[model samples]
Target chain A: MATDRPLTAKGLATRARIVAAAADLVFHRGAAQVALADVQAAADVSGSQLYHYFTDRDDLLRAVAVHRAAELVANQGPVDTLPALRAWVEANIALIAADNAAGGCRLGSLVPQLAETDPQTRATLSTAFHDWIAHLAAGLTTMTATGVLPPTADPHRLATLLVAALEGGILLAQAQRDITPMRTALEAALDHIASLATSP
Target chain B: MATDRPLTAKGLATRARIVAAAADLVFHRGAAQVALADVQAAADVSGSQLYHYFTDRDDLLRAVAVHRAAELVANQGPVDTLPALRAWVEANIALIAADNAAGGCRLGSLVPQLAETDPQTRATLSTAFHDWIAHLAAGLTTMTATGVLPPTADPHRLATLLVAALEGGILLAQAQRDITPMRTALEAALDHIASLATSP
Candidate 1:
């Protein structure tokens, strides 16, 4: 059974707005820098209203993590084929480039700060990453089944590596305020994947 | 010219102790959570003593970053050969496992939290990473010059990927509290390097 009760349409809208604002603030400002009042101010909601939607700051932070994870998954679009998978990887790199490397991967940046400090937030972020990796793995599996990749290719392991490379690249790019590291890292990951293709 | 004035032998020891204590606190507790008082308490120094050693908290943080970076470089030992490089990669993964994934890479953990919010900190971290990449690239260059690696292998680019993979793998391992992702990701990176070796 679900822990949270279903909300009406109006309640859902207000909750979504609060989450969006919180996510924005947390991403731009470090999580530690953003307080409940900042969230309330950004969301344009009163104190009682903020409490009504989420029990406390930690609860809202967990929600923001989930919201950001879902946004990343959705933005990735579909990835059932090899070309589609490459596109998915490129799209992530493009996002960093588009932002001019100001902000790195939403999950990558936030998860590190919270993972060791808070257990609950760590679990939320871990599950989010596992789910994202699963999506990419499914696409790699399709590639193997469709004869694009060799039978020996392990989709889950490969997917994990791809995610790691992307996160690492994003971190480097953000620190340097340049996108070359991100691009080169992702391209290297793609080349590795290509090497696993069935030899024609 | 040097920006910081030279210190007496006793002063150097005291400053090193302060930095070591602050680095420990910041590593266990997030950077934002550790204050100057905590650093002073941990380092066993008075208010004036702490301030006299460093201009402020930010200066101390930059010192910690530099100290941690040097520690990592020193701990990595020598990485002149392909075997040496593989050993370096394994040592990093071993570090995550040894800590039980409690705290990730010391530099990796702190850099992300500070990089986006503070430009000066970002520059410090970027230089540290660039220095790290340069070290790895130097090893790869030796491999190429010795004819161990193919001439076509770009040492700088390959070094960048290796660093990226290592950081990414460490982040993933810390989040999941498991070392498999890091091991797998790094093995894939090593395999890529092996593929570049020249034939006997």
Candidate 2:
């Protein structure tokens, strides 16, 4: 668990810096390879300050996971229609392409490493994904309510599938060092959702 | 590079045992967390024996990745038609459920960790995925040749999408600790392929 003590504004700023630094390192370098000293150097915080913010490396990792989830959610904003969902996916693909398809999805990259070994961390990630799916589902629900999608469309299920396909596409793209795989996979997913449209 | 020396029958057995044990450890414990001592203890091999087989942990990890790819390919057997493809996907879902959705795809789990950090290992995993994708594409190609799929269907693209969705679905299911996400994602992929049928 993270520290429960109250923090001043400066302390909060310092904590956020540490988490951002840790998130970058963990995303590029695997969690097992990152050390507290690395985080300290990256964040330019003293040893005592690092310990003050996080109880241990695991605690810091939890913070990084949360930070990443928040960043992803924030970047995605809201999705209230199929075009919004498609644009959200395109943004993800564009991000990967911008990075040369080198690193995959931040959450996707971390979950496989930590999900089985750390139950608490896994739960945090799972909740992040659940919330993410819920956000997408909410958009789909609106589309259905507005009569854009067929009444038979299950927003929850479709949203889950969209997220799943996106993660998988990112993985394949990273592995192949190309964006086409990701693009094709996501295109198929969006097409599937469009097929659920009432006019289709 | 691995050792260039030829191994006797007994030597081959020892090397295979070390890789198998390492694969098991890396599957349950993240690659970074599994130590040399853990590999030695799990394989019941002496320190020198471990070093003699693998120059370092990275080498061992590469071997494990290859071993995992072989195992996955062997498990999938063949995919020559839409039904065969569906069965292949069903088998993957069943394997995850059998493990209680504890550990996701071995390749999916490892690719994110090592793909960015190690180029050689990334290449190994990339080739494995490429080969796996080719196998699926072969099935789709056969379907097209047999008039089951329309000429408009690009086997390579569809195969890539299928793999991407499977990996993504497995990641979501593993994170959520449920099989529904994986099942749904795969069902969508298979359905997409089915929609490419000549009549459809």
Candidate 3:
């Protein structure tokens, strides 16, 4: 019943704009400090327009979480080849570095804030991560099938560590505000992952 | 001037109680939502006593961040043996899992919140992390020297990844509300770490 109506083209555009603004504001400020008015102001939309796009702030936040999740996955890049995985990881480090540690792992940040207080919001975050892990798992599976990884390398386990390590990199990077720890840590993780592929 | 005075015994006890209460509250409730009154209520201290212990709420938070940082490093346990490392990780996961993902990482949650807005606060969080990394590096370096790990292994790099992995694992484990990912990821990371050990 809740999923009944699909927004039209114009409506979808407005929704996207709101989500983008909300995410940027939350990243810079914080979810706690951001007001609904800030979202409308940043998006350059009227209050009525904001309400039209989403019923309330929570709805907008959920949409923002979805938007932010897409950006996280998108930043991983197209790791089509074994070498591409390294490139993807380096690009990820650069992307994180560019944010100056101010912009954290979007889905990771939002998940902690929303997970406990709101069940539906928690579910939304859980779904975002589930999709993220699935994408990674699929990538690892393809690499394994391509003989880029040894038969003993479990794609699921490798993918789990990949996600874990990347998130870990982000945590340290943010704390230090320097990319070295994040870069060094990730390179080591990639090296570990690559070591599994070398013999194959 | 700030570090000049030796605190009275009563002052020390009051400050300790306040810090402990603040840690518990902020760790459970989002830090931003936590108020002085909440800390006072939780600590069973009066408003004046709270202010006496901490000049302001930020002071209390900074102290809590430091205390939590100490706890974080302490959680790593004794690194006297390889089996101890394994046991430390196991206990850490159990501690995190027992919380049911309701309370996010205290230092991590506070660090990002401070990153863009407060330089002093950010530095405080950074200091905590620096201490954490240092302890880890010490253990890893010892492992290398004792021939538990290959001399070729960069203990610094490995230690850096280990910290990141633990934070990431906690984040994921909390989100999934399942211990499997955290345990699996940590074990895999440890396995990778152990693979570098020189066989006796």
Q: Estimate the lDDT of model 1.
A: 0.82
Per-residue lDDT tens digits of candidate 2, residues B124-176?
Answer: 88888889888889988999999989888888888877888888888988888
Query: Which segments of candidate 1 are over 4 A away from where they belong?
Result: A1-6, B1-5
At residue A90, what lDDT does model 2 achieve? 80
The reply for model 2, stretches above 4 Å from the true place, is A1-3
For A1-200, candidate 2 gives per-residue lDDT tens digits of 35677998998999999999998888777787799999999999998999899899988988888888888778766677777887888888888898767768888788887787778888888888889889889999999998989788888878877888789888887888988888988887888788778863
- For every candidate, how close is chain A to the native chain A in TM-score? 0.91, 0.94, 0.87
* Candidate that scores best on lDDT: 2
Q: A39-94, model 3: which lDDT tens digit per residue?
A: 98999999888887788887877777778767766665555457787887877777
Winner of 2 and 3 under DockQ: 2
Better of 1 and 3 by TM-score: 1
How far is A128's C-alpha from truth in model 1 (Å)?
1.4
Fnat, 2 decimals, each candidate = 0.54, 0.74, 0.59
Q: Identify the candidate with maximal TM-score.
A: 2
lDDT minimum window of 10 residues, candidate 1 chain A: A1-10
What TM-score does candidate 3 get on C-alpha atoms? 0.91
Could you give candidate 3's fraction of true interface contacts? 0.59
Encode model 1's per-residue lDDT on B1-200: one tens digit a residue.
01267788998899899999999998888787889999999999998989888888878888888788778767757777988987888778777888866777788777668877778778877887888888888998989999988888888888888888888888888778888888888888877788778964
Chain A, candidate 2, TM-score of: 0.94
lDDT of 1 at A132: 79
- In Å, residue A163's CA in model 2 sits off its true spot by 0.9
What's the best-to-worst order under TM-score? Answer: 2, 1, 3
